[model samples]
Target: MMTDAGEQLEVQLDDCPPGRETFNDPLQEDASGPDSHLSSALRELEEPLLLLADVALAPPCGRAVFYSCPEAERVERSLQSVQLQLHFLLSKADDLHDCLLGGQGHVEREALAAAISSLLYTCQPYFNHLESTARSTMAQYTHVPADMCSTLLDFSQQLCDKLEQLVLTYASYGLLSLNEAEPDSASHFCVGQTQLGQLKLTIFRYCQPTPYLSRANTQLYKRMRWNVERVRDQQQTEEEDGDDEEETFTDYYFLCYEDIPNPHAEANEDSEGVSDGSVVRMWSIGQWVQANPDPSTEDIWDWILCEVPQGGYNRLLFLGHDEPSSRSATDYLQQLLLSCCTD
Candidate 1:
């Protein structure tokens, strides 16, 4: 996806200097001493710093570890950023609790709760994605060095635990949803934890590489997980005799127009309207359906991928394939178009 020049730029960007650490806050320093109880408590509360050395440099387990890669290191840095942000907000939460309990007005307390909720909401998706990627990466490891796989799982488990605590704390303070029906708890957290556990279980069940995919075998189990529509289709097909569906088409039309600026325009707004290059692709799908109410099965694929071009726009279709399972049908559609283009 990247050109040689682009790759060189990426390498240069990666070589940029690391910024100074801001872990120490002079204002938060205790007057007593480093050994003071307050200072010690604050130090203990510092967030977890994900270190690549801690994860990858340890004794080798029988199974391979995913953290040996540079990409994994970048992931670790991102995780550390999230952890640090969580800790920062947690300290604020503690302050707000103290302020509210000290008879602060409802408005201020409500605002603090809102702040906490916003921060936690922002974190949910990032951590969820991170955990998902980690699970998928671990699945690729065949003979996971016993030391590597278990240690990596342990790191993932720790991250999950930290996120869970933060979510529960925010919920307790009325800043987050504790609803079982909500995606945060029921969908995201549950699925993430389950996936992480499955990763560990894969390594556990299969001391060595095995063909079978269980919660234990990363590749087999993870890949086999079907999407909702596919599952539903399977269920329906099983109930019936898996009869093929017929296709139909009908005609549809829309008014065509060239770029014409609207009469009403604000001073700051551009009055030129859409560019002349802009084109609208129109097709009579309804007419096509009416023309062939029961078209041949073989024609469907072609019909879908067929391109319909108009003045300025074009429409192309793509078919989904099951493979290493990286990109979706939509992602491949762009590539398909590029492939058809003149060099």
Candidate 2:
């Protein structure tokens, strides 16, 4: 739970710099049991929790800040503390959910439920951003041991579990009332509007190392669940019987310099018939309609936004090595923004 702070967490960190902060422990000496356990976890967290909070609460600025390598001991300690905290938090949340005095509807009406929902809703982008930046931001930049990989994976699952539990507990309950009309209650959602000629783009870096989401099928497995390797085996199982052929694989453009051989050179030509050595492709509502010959394409777009799963989308693959320290998606992102402004 991020409290409304007097100053931004970023400013506090710059001035106090984590370990240097003079933090007075708020735990009363008389406390025992669960309270004592929580206090101990918090005490161990000290500064690393603040760093996590800062990242969680910060606005999505479309830039990945890979932390400079830290002492291995510090990294392990920080990760361990987070694991401990998450375990306690999940246990307590489950306990509270079970002990609620009234029915689910009654619990949903409580301000506590609404507040928790709001906080989690606000953090929707944070986890998505984390999934995108997990590889380079932590392991590659932190320079930690290979042994930490399992620990890190366990932490990731625990974090995801906490999120799943909370969502199941309060997502629709706190946000939507059974009595209220869909249009009225749905107004609380993070909705966007677009007019004719409108174009909105958000940039994100790919940081998932394991599967790396290289293709539509690989990305599809990730959305199905994180155990992608297993998904490959169980994909055609009777339980998951569905029309696999309907699943679309995005056509991708291999982006590289003029010196590099164009993968699609045989068909290379721009709308204006000018090749500036830049591979090009596009996706839009209009283009989507044109690409798919389905008669219900427009209607499909309207209802499918909520049902649309992550994956099966075309992703840009750069030819060169993506150096964590020297160059990453952030640098290319800067140029994209500059070009947008230039146009």
Candidate 3:
């Protein structure tokens, strides 16, 4: 009783996958009507259809996939942006590594300059003296060829310009503390013939408050002295009561040991037991506190470089105060440097 078209539909329904039987499907007639199961099937198959469409649109060389969904496209763009930044960092690090290696290799100035110029795209954005420092380091080698020095100087000048730009950029970002430009990279050459040293130019992002400066006064000095005496008294009292053993405390000292050339030699006026002369001067932190409760204000960072006496190791005291802004502290450092030079 079925017509040709009806017969074809019947045959297709009979061949339908098991459990997906269309013969008794309540939504079969609705395929072209409301709540159509056919529509639901088409919606589920949309991703596959898109994939086929992409393949058809792709070039013969290769295929690129794209999502038409707006949210998906936005996420893809964000991911690409992150990837680009990461690549930039990797390239910058590689350039720095190459520069360090080139210095070690004793490469010619022109070559170093080329490498630096290539990498300047990244370094000049963050560091102001990168090129000058690199050039200074290269020029410091006494063995450097004469012909290359001029080229190196040119490179150094260019580097300085780039560095200035970088510093200004960082300053705009509230990075550097001081606005004044530093001494030319040439100053590093003061230690001629010594292996070139590297100094990192650092920029702090925020201004920090200075540490508390302990003011020196007669009363405070006396108090600290008394505190030291009290500690000794407590130790003595404990010993007298036999409640504890003597406790050792830390103090900075310059220790010198005389080596005896002949241990068996008898003591005599000239011989003095036949020994090598050794002398050590001991300095105590208590003495400093007693002398100046408050030291002068100077850059304590530079003060630490003062020389130690007698061509021997010097012991510097920190007194639990890592930061020093006191005038007396600067005086103490000057004293050490003067004594060392005198000795």
lDDT of each: 0.32, 0.32, 0.28
lDDT of 1 at 282: 23
TM-score of each: 0.29, 0.32, 0.18
| Candidate 1: C-alpha lDDT | 0.32
Ranking by TM-score: 2, 1, 3
Please give the range of 10 consecutive residues that has the lowest summed lDDT in model 1. 200-209
**Model 3: runs farther than 4 Å from truth?**
1-68, 102-343
lDDT of 1 by residue, 1-343 (tens): 1133233323322232222121121111111112232222223322222232234443366643455468466545645554554444344445445654563566665555444333333233333333333443333333323433344444444544444455455456665454423333211222121132212101101011121211122121111111111112445555675655532222121111122243454435337754442433221100012122234446675556644311111223312222221112212322332354324
The TM-score that candidate 1 achieves is 0.29
lDDT comparison, 1 vs 3, better candidate: 1
lDDT of 3: 0.28
Query: What TM-score does model 2 achieve against the real structure?
Result: 0.32
Candidate 3 clashing pairs?
A: 128-163, 216-293, 216-294, 295-326, 295-327, 295-328, 296-326, 296-327, 296-328
lDDT of 2 by residue, 1-343 (tens): 2222212322332233222114222111111112232222133333553344233322235654344445434555556555554454455445435534354556434544434333322222332332223332333343333344344434444544454455445545553332212322211221111111122222211111212232233312111111000123234543466544323222121112113334665555679985665443321110111122343455766445533232233333332422331123323433433354469
lDDT of 3 at 170: 31
lDDT of 3 by residue, 20-139 (tens): 233222111111111233323222222321222222232234444344577355434433432333334344444444444455443432333333222322222212221222222333
Q: List the residue pairs that clash in candidate 2.
A: none
Better of 1 and 2 by TM-score: 2
